[model samples]
Target: MRHARPLPTYLVQRYHGWKATAYHENKAWYRRLAKEGQHPRAMVISCCDSRVHVTSIFGADQGEFFIHRNIANLVPPHKPDGDLHGTSAALEYAVNVLKVAHIVVMGHSNCGGVKGCYDMCSGHAPELEEQASYVGRWMDLLRPGYERTAEIADPAERTRAMERQAVLVSLENLMTFPFVREAVEGEVMTLHGLWNDIGEGDLECYDPAKGDFVRV
Candidate 1:
């Protein structure tokens, strides 16, 4: 707690502005939401990238979507060893408690985490290969994705493919959890994969039939 600092002046000013405007305008709605509690329709697992705004892309309002962001938006396969698993904990709550109807694993272009994984797996990033690197350990989750996309001749295209593979890998891993599998198999939940082109503002959704991402 001693390490924590007070809110920055600019952020405080921005918060005061929001409290004066948007919050004031929707005071009753906010109060109602507080009273009724949240019942989000979907759980969106997206990257920690600042450019990927899940709410803005879907035009969703407060409490409409449950969102969780991590590096590369990767989800490790189900492990019940009682270890610290933030993503799995979020998924458990979203599926069992919140009963979200859909789970979307969203990845984006120019993802630093994906790039790090690519570099590490390609033996180009020795620093990331160290045991002391937290980022390296986290990026290990995307090793499968890197392996899947390693053969592409074009570097740029290969990177993009790796990004999309992150989404695909997460979607696949989501099913590894028993709750997720039960929900999906019982027809109560659905899984989706998405890749966003940050520069062009284009969103592509994975099409099972086509075995590729189709622009939406």
Candidate 2:
């Protein structure tokens, strides 16, 4: 039989402290926010990494951004499955329901998904074929980019190439939805790509001018 485990003592204490602070110190903001609906101006597509906090990075207050997080923040080709597509659902809601003006797809350093695709494309991660998971299938979108970029000599270059490729793929996939395409072409909606590094606190933007991500 499995034994019952206790919650992390530190986490429990933090949770209680946060609850007390919210109830005592931040009640007004919470009450107003709770009564009103979110009217965010942007939707940010980001990874599920614990270190990458979108709110902290963007310096946004509550209800500023509608965030959609997946394994690698991939916007898959729109498929009408009669079921919910998590990322696509957020896009539809943000664009149609909320009418957000900007949609930002933020990629980052040391991305496990990009690294996984690089490994698979270079014949280093054969197990991807055996594991028929969503991540395995979703990450296949980067195959062409990884294959093309691996011809370079440096591993660092290949990783960077893969990272940028994922962002570009997401941007392209966003257009696969007819609504997104229409909104984008009509100039009512805009798309952006951003890169981040935790160690150096370096933020970069994908510059259309230079055709690369440079320091912001």
Candidate 3:
């Protein structure tokens, strides 16, 4: 702990600025939130891309959303084995403890994780195939999505399709959890899939009936 670096000056300055402005303006609200534990109505599983501003995009206030970000917004099939399952743990707490009414898996355009899966599956990235590669192992979840979009000839289109596939895959995997399935079956909770076009600032939501993403 002694070797830990001090906070960067610019970040420290920004924090102070936020404290003076936003925090000062909403002191009562912030205090109320601190006194009362969070009771978020939704849980959002999104990519760890800095460009994907989950709260900003949804115009959410603090403590309104319970968010979990991973490589490609993936949710692995429910496995009860004793392992360090970070995403699964978050999901369990969100569904059972928080009792969130909705779980949203939001993928985004040009995700590095999705692209890496494409490269590895296409035989372009051999390094990722190694057993010790943490990223490679994590991205293995996206392999099925790549396979589903393999028939597309255009590289860009294929990647785009795969991005949407990631959302679909997570939605399907969420149901694999017994708690999630029970909540959904009893109409206590719902699942949603979303894709964000970062460049265009466009949002798309999955339409289960049409089996495609529709512009939002």
Model 1 C-alpha RMSD vs. true structure (Å) is: 1.1
Q: What is the C-alpha RMSD of each candidate to the true structure, in Å?
A: 1.1, 2.6, 1.0
Candidate 1 C-alpha lDDT tens digits along 1-216: 899999999999999999999999999999999999999999999999898999999999999999999999999889989443999999999999999999999999999998888788888999999999888988888888777875797877888899999988888888889999999999999999999999999999999999999999
Model 2 Cα lDDT, one tens digit per residue, 3-91: 97888999999989988886669888878889998889999999887878999987998889999987666788888883338788889
After superposing candidate 3 on the true structure, give the runs of residues whose Cα lies further than 4 Å from its correct spot: 82-84
lDDT of candidates 1 onward, in order: 0.91, 0.83, 0.93
State residue 53's C-alpha deviation in candidate 2, in Å.
1.2
Residue 37 shift from truth in candidate 2, angstroms: 1.1
Clashing pairs in 2: none
Q: Give each model a TM-score.
A: 0.97, 0.89, 0.97
lDDT of 3 by residue, 105-142 (tens): 99999999998888888998999999888888888888
Which scores better on lDDT, 2 or 3?
Answer: 3
Q: Which stretches of candidate 2 lie over 4 Å from their true place?
A: 1-7, 81-84
Best by lDDT: 3
Q: Between 1 and 3, whose TM-score is larger?
A: 3
